[model samples]
Target: MENKTRTLYMIPYIGWIILFVVAPIALVVYYSFFDIHGNFTVGNYGKFFTPVYLKMAISSFWYAFLITIISLAAAYPTAYLLTKTKHKQLWLLLIIVPSWVNLLLKAYAFIGIFGAHGAANQFLDIIGIGTKQLLFTDFSFVFVSVYIFIPFMILPIFNALDNLNPSLLDATKDLGASKWTTFRRVILPLTLNGVKSGIQVVFIPSLSLFMLTRLIAGNRVITLGTAIEQHFLVTQDWGMGSTIAVFLIIAMFLIMALTGFRRRGA
Candidate 1:
């Protein structure tokens, strides 16, 4: 009866995974072998290897890398500071509150903030920087992407720091290790898994960001996500879209494999 009950509980979870995850991926793979006219062809896969697609892939990777790096740079310090705060949970909650808002809403809010004659430009003018076009630029895209992803990056790192053993720090100090030395040799290595987890969350989504490229970047930037959207929605080319998605899925899996840390025991 216990075994039957366990199987019953798993049925829904397994079914959901099959329906939402496995099925969609299988369909994408299937469609990737076809042409726009629904004819079976491997040409879509070949097309992805072309210079245009290759460049788009590289550009997508570069943007994702930049977002991940900047988020880490900002988040690690912020997270470490949060760990030192008396009201760390409250502060962390406040930092994360902005992320609770819908991404579309946040993106639109930035549109107003970064628009010409917008708050950003107005502030620039006041500071003698003068108003400049902020919206629909690489800067805006990267800035907004970083802002959106920072909370996610911080949360994991904060958890890592919060859960760290205090005795280790004391032992380090007893051994005459300086703050920087302790951090470099001990703290960082221990928290490295959390950093990897943060990177996994931030970098993967950054690779497939389409809306930000449109509204914030004014379509000036083309990531794999934007290309996939264009092929699927604008050009009505499911085969190519699926092909791009397949490669993206492969990339996502590769990242997951790299970022995933093994537990101490089986």
Candidate 2:
């Protein structure tokens, strides 16, 4: 009777994962390797290997890498400092609060700041320089993504850095290492796990980001997300949409696997 009761309690958690996470993945797997007219078709997967799809996948990774590197470089130090603070809880809140902002809203807000008539351009014009259209460019998308994911990177790094052994640095210093040498040899190596966790956590979904690329970047940047949206809504092509979705999943999984390997290596 007690075992049955315990099993029942666990069932809810297991069922929830199955219900939400597993089921959708199964559906994607089914669709990705099959056809559209409600039949089995490998053509979708076949078509996915073409140059255009490859280019999009490459482009997505290209941007994703940019954002990940930028976010990590910026967030790691902030997280390290916050984690080491006497008033750690307060500083952690400061790092986290921006993450609670609506993603779309934040993207849109970037539009207000980076658009041709936006504050940045206005400042440039004031300096007697010709204004550049910052919005709707690839740089804009990357810049905005870095901004959005900054907090995600920070939180993980803070968790890892917060739990870090400060005394380990003291030991390294006592062994006749300069501060930079100790930081390079000890602190960085110790913090690698957090950095790995943060990069994986930030890059995967950030690549799927449609709104940020769409609004700030216009349609010039067609992510797998935007392509899927186009097939479904604009072209009414569910098969192609599903195909793009499958590609996205594969690409994301590859990135995640790389992340996992890197984490283990770290």
- Give the best candidate by lDDT: 1
Candidate 2 minimal-lDDT segment of 10 residues? 257-266
For residues 1-266, what per-residue lDDT tens digits would candidate 1 score against the true structure? 99999999999999999999999999999999999899999999999999999999999999999999999999999999999999999999999999999999999999999999799999999999899999998999999999999999999999998899999999999999999999998899889888999999999999999999999999998999998998888999999999999999999999988788455332
Worst 10 residues of 1 by lDDT: 257-266
TM-score of 2: 0.89
- C-alpha TM-scores of all predictions: 0.95, 0.89
How far in Å is the alpha carbon of 238 misplaced in model 1? 0.7
| Residue pair clashes in candidate 2 | 35-41
lDDT by residue for model 2 over 199-258, one digit each (tens)? 888888877778777788887887778777787789766677788887677767787687
Local distance difference test scores for all models: 0.95, 0.80
Colliding pairs, model 1? none
Best by TM-score: 1
